[model samples]
Target: MLDSETKATETPEDHADELRLWLRLLTCTTLIEGEVRGRLRERFDVTLPRFDLMAQLDKAPDGMTLSDVSKRMMVSNGNVTGLVERLVESGHLDRRTSETDRRVQVIRLTKLGRAEFRRMASEHETWIADLFADLTPKDVRELMRLLAKTKASAQKSAARRRP
Candidate 1:
């Protein structure tokens, strides 16, 4: 009774559950990410990339090379260099030459940076919790399990795609 073009434009109800599930996941992730980005900008005057860089340093107290940071963050070296320079000027991070490799530069968060990052991280967690407040504990657990499976599958697919 319906033309092909009209059928294609129909709602997810007309399609497979997988299509609906993927759309829901994408929408939820986008909504949450946008909220977090806005909050960070409004409250901290910081960008997501800077926050993520600080988070990486938080995990490694000693410090990591500029190259290491680039690899871990999956960003370009130039990008990491710029962030490191800005944070250093702001007194939130410190950069030093590696003792063993003079050519290598290591970066680490300063005391101020660590404290600030902790505050940001705490608030970020609260925001996420609030966003999912409607979900029951059981629902949360099940969602996490399913997401883990999905992530593993995606990772395998990515690996296969790599040369």
Candidate 2:
């Protein structure tokens, strides 16, 4: 059987609405991701994964492990390891051998990392909010509700495919 993407070439007249929704969603995601990535590079000279890891650490005062970052970021364990190593080398974070479990290494943001994360996090929120600033409160609420439902359905589909 052809994959959904391959079958999408049929351009079924009956599926026009779904096609339009997917195209719009794709365009929106690409635009937002590109803009945010450009802003991060221009403002902080930091990669998204490194910034994301720092953001995760910023939320937890006690810090977390490499596996924790991998789970939260939805990245491979090897990718997390490389990113964490680079951050540690840059003086933005540290990984200490766990005392309770000597086999585990816990990662945390340094003072410099926390300060940088605060600045970036503030700007990130402003940028995201600005994207919807033209919408009224009702519009924003409705969009959030619809998007949440769509997101949940997509997640369920992905989960079903996993095993």
- Against the true structure, candidate 2 reaches a TM-score of 0.83
| lDDT of candidate 2 over 31-147, digit per residue (tens) | 988888888999988877788889899988899988888999999999988998899999999889999998788999999989989999999889888876899999989989999
Using Cα atoms with residue i matched to residue i, what is each candidate's TM-score against the true structure? 0.79, 0.83
Root-mean-square deviation of every model: 6.0, 5.5
Model 1 Cα lDDT, one tens digit per residue, 53-104? 9999999999999999999999999999899998999999999999998999
Name the candidate that leads on lDDT.
1
- CA error at residue 84 for candidate 2, angstroms: 0.7
**Candidate 1 residue spans exceeding 4 A from truth:** 1-20
Best by TM-score: 2
